[model samples]
Target: MATKSNSTKTSSSKKGKMNLKDIPFSKERLIELFRQMLLGRRFEEKCGQQYQMKKFSGFCHLYIGQEAVAVGSIAALEIGKDYVFTTYRDHVHALILGISAKEVMAELFMKRTGSSHGKGGSMHFYNGKTRFMGGNGIVGGHTPLATGAAFASKYRGDGAVALCYMGDAAVNQGTFHESLNMAGLWGLPIVYIVENNIYGMGTSTERSCAQPELWKRTGDAYNIPGRQVNGMDMLEVYEATRQAVEDARNGQPVFLEMLCYRYRGHSMSDPATTYRTKDEVGQWRMKDPIERLKEQFPTVFTESMVKDMEEEIKQEVADSIKFAEDSELPELSDIWTDVCVDYPGYPGREASDNKYEFPYEQLENAKK
Candidate 1:
């Protein structure tokens, strides 16, 4: 097991000390991390704007303040070789994992060019080539799927590791426990990350969980080593993930609780203010991940460099919106496509002789 760092601060009160010399990444890599976080921040901000303009429908959860949790941890992994699974608040993760911004935005617009081909909107972005498993909707549902991915890697003797991300609320679900038990028992190469932003929907962790110190939740039961890191600090998230990934590759499963916060509501329909105070939100915002990175490395992230990056990101996001707007929606025939894999000797291997019909049309005819 990787030794825990005494310097890892769980709360925003201390704003843990970050030494530039301690960061394993080069200066250029540090700048790249900043850019990734900035891109995520800008992209999510645009998503909120588009949602308000009614450009897309359905539940839209923003990873507004939690940019570091995705950017930092992903930076530690070998992208195409390793696998990643995240919850519905997943646009940022998709972007960081090399899913083109245009494809992700198009997915949000429900266009045919989406990662999931307009069928799996908002909470279902997928990229098989990159091995980004999915943007799963159910609270704790994807845990088992991630465990299976780790099992596959171990079965194949592949050195790849699987990283599963979830919210604080998901810890209470039975699947979370079941999946971890399997991983621990089988020594699967996986890392279970809980983005404990203190709230599960409108309910705070104190109310929803009997023990809110989430990092400690998995260790005793599963024999998996668990650690809490300042998710707001990208470097800390990266370092911890790097060690955990090493351990996972050696057939040891680990649990990480990223102490972070989301600036947006649970979904687009939620106002978020009903449950939390403006003062509390402000405090977390002061410890914003993007700003914290800038403060930690002023020499690397100069004002001009940051301004240039922001402008470039701004245009990139704008182009993505244009691409989504110009792209066509999925063809009506697409409804029957990609639903299931077909193979020889399968029950429905032959094409249907009957013409395809829309289900809603049938319902309308029945009403008549």
Candidate 2:
């Protein structure tokens, strides 16, 4: 399945004056993109608030400054047909990939109404209907799963592509390299995107990765073509991902390094000020993805329209919080469900029958 190498290209600059008619997307489509990014931003903000209030108990990673990477890349794929796999910093990706804000929030809340039915909390959101594989917790762990998905697509001859997203740190993981090797060898239809936000959990990429230039990391070893895109600019992300998706669909595996930023700390626990300076953070904020999009097309995004969108997103976030609050927690029996296929002697089957015989005597004894 080895395919010919495709040349890596950078995103075209949208500098100088550009008319509304000259924009690639239609007016309604651009507005939709803006709304999605805004929704992601607002939803994550509410998540931060809830985590601080002790609404959920787990490691919570917020996607504050990296909206464009998820929204723009996903906007290029055929949703429900192509598959998506993201890292633990996954709320925004889940929302962008068609998992409802309500379901995602419910997952964060650890309620049964969550995408994972409460079993998988904030870091493992899954929805088969939307082809969202999961919000995997282990760094670079899900890359192989995404690769396998692409292999399946190739085996079935389905023109579907797998978009695997990871943090800058995950690129150094052994699984990341292994997955890329297999994808490159098999010519799988997969796009590996590294959201190079400059840090891998407080350790800056420069201090961590031997080659901080992540896009250049793939070509020599795996024969995979890589491109770096301005992840702060939504249009640039979309355009770059669109081309990558096209190449991937043709059995040409591609790699994209999105130059984005995460305003929040690695997780809820870190204040993010100890390592990076406030001035550095402020500089990145100046190039916020949402603001960049609006500035690029001022004629398209009117002040009133932007206000209405913000208000609408505010209500939506409120509704999601309410939905999460009202949802029920998973039952004790749910622990055994969704674990294995039904068989005559399987633990889940026996548990379902109330036999409750298992190696973990504590749980079985408790049932008795």
Candidate 3:
């Protein structure tokens, strides 16, 4: 059994300190950990810089500080069997699911070679091969779709799972409750992840949710089990997700509400500094999931570990831009090529009739 770790805060007013003594900690794993967070953070940072330069445009929600939720949760899933679905803050999630940074960047650049054929941009991302279910721009709309996917897994007896994630504010929507009730009743093979980032747009969670224990949003309505976990610590997020995954595999759909905070605004347009105090951001910065882990592991680690990570990630980010820029855009005919399939005047067409592709554009608009 993995030893349970409880986080402790630096201040007495804080909850608990960060600890990861139980899990097998290794330099390689830690390096990979740093890589994931660094990649996500650097990618988001680059997107912002690019947006300013007009190299990339259109709705971009940077996931600068929320890397832990994507990386840790992804570590718990078996790719090709599990599905990744989330709200508009989705680039990191898609990347963690193995979407190439180059393709993601190309999409951001609106080049036809990128994911969604350059349709998704920064907020909407998807890759069928990676089992990434794409990002939903709607507030709480994807909840039902994820639930339906989970229900499909069970219906097919595929031993698969679906992870549905949403913001703390999305809980206020009617679909959130409707899906929770459905999942609870049917015992779907899904893990409900409530990313309680403390605020929804300009509104704080406290002001937005009358009961800020937003994880318990549907506690009274359904008997589905749920728990609150610290979202800032990667290992803590990994462990909780592991437990929830196992339970869901064993016929119990678990709801995990990770108490997280975004260091940036809701999107590129919204100014996060307005609602959140710098002191609050500073406190959370000290408890950075990557920094906290570096402090915990190798017993006697040095400064080089952090510096080397930065250097390596910087080069990697540079290479990613090169790759995306070098990648060729889709041919003009590709627009209609992927549109619809013909009868082909061949047999077995009836056997392939069950396939369906998401109408990404229409869905994105309807969501807002």
Candidate 4:
């Protein structure tokens, strides 16, 4: 696969603009990046089709326009070494991490064959082999968990790093600060990536954030190194993420904010818009990342090649949906099977579940 990243792999300027001239690695690599991106787009469209047929019936956050970050970061990462955790918009990361489309589709269908065995639906994807953490649903709760994962990596003296992904809305939460402080103070090997999509669930950036220059957020006592990149550009994201991961492995944690946009609503449940204007959306549509990259990448591939790639991705996505549709749903018996470790006598047969209540009470009791 062509590397196709925009990263210079050199020290960035203080403002953190990546030198993208070094990203396009090889023809094969560019095509690979293009294929992965097409797959992500097709997956979202397939999800919409499945949902319309009632095969998937929960909160589904599609990764239609947000493919570059996942593809870029995952390209820079190793399956077993680096860990990735992200918000509910995580199918792209899971897909990039080698989770089977059959299992992912089955999970969306609420079948026992799901990656999380039907327990973790669209928002709770998991795969142990790839080291992807979860499709966390809480607003900003997963930041500390990312820190802890890096802390664990450090504790084991493994050079592995943790890649924490979240959105612009999440940066406003207290955990974002707390986790950054802990990671910087203790020097955890973590890359805090904020996918700034410009809108956080209908809220404008300036209206919600006190200071929307989100990359500069690492300036507090923790002194985390921060950078801003063009998220829509895979090369830009790849360049920024490569350095950030390298810096983390060297004991300097990095915070990165990428400016991007979502082409759709918050989820399948939400109408396309209640906050932003169509004119604004159309303006962004002019800068379509996929189209721009298709031209930028292939010296030989043509418009027909682009069309052929689209067709191939659509076929794969269609097959994935069929696999999910034909797949069976989790049995009622499966409902009780994954409750707890003691739910079964066998040591390895144990399963995990979403805690019944917020774990605060349990934490308070333990403190007492």
Number of the top candidate by TM-score? 2
How close is every model to the real structure, measured as TM-score?
A: 0.90, 0.91, 0.84, 0.86
Cα misplacement distance, residue 363 of candidate 3 (Å): 40
lDDT of each: 0.88, 0.88, 0.77, 0.79
Candidate 2 TM-score, C-alpha based:
0.91
**Considering summed lDDT, which 10 consecutive residues are worst modelled in model 4?**
1-10
- Model 4, range 270-302, lDDT digits (tens) per residue? 676778889988876765667667656455456
Q: Write the per-residue lDDT of candidate 2 for residues 1-368, one digit (tens) a residue.
A: 23335335476756434576766789899899889999989999999999999999899999999999998999999999999999988888888777899999998898999988888888888778779998898999999999999999999999999999999999999999999999988999999999999988889999998888888888767878888898988888988889899989998899999999999899999998878999999999988988888887887787998998999999999999999999999987787665666624554556456665556878889899
> Candidates 1 and 4: which is better by TM-score?
1
lDDT of 4: 0.79
Estimate, for each residue in 1-368, the C-alpha lDDT of model 3 and write its tens digit. 11111211211122334334456456566567668887898888987887788877788888877788888888889988898789989988877777888778888887777887876677789878878887899999999999999999999989888999998888899998889889878888889898888888988888977777765655445656767878887777887888888878766777888877788888888877778899998888877866665665645234876678778778877777777777776765454444447524233433455334556899999999
How far in Å is the alpha carbon of 202 misplaced in model 4? 1.0
Off by over 4 Å in 1: 1-20, 343-368
Candidate 1 structure quality by residue, lDDT tens digits, 133-203: 98999999999999999999999998999999999999999999999999988999999999999998999
TM-score of structure candidate 4 = 0.86
Regions more than 4 Å wrong, model 4? 1-21, 344-368
Candidate 1 yields a Cα-based lDDT of: 0.88
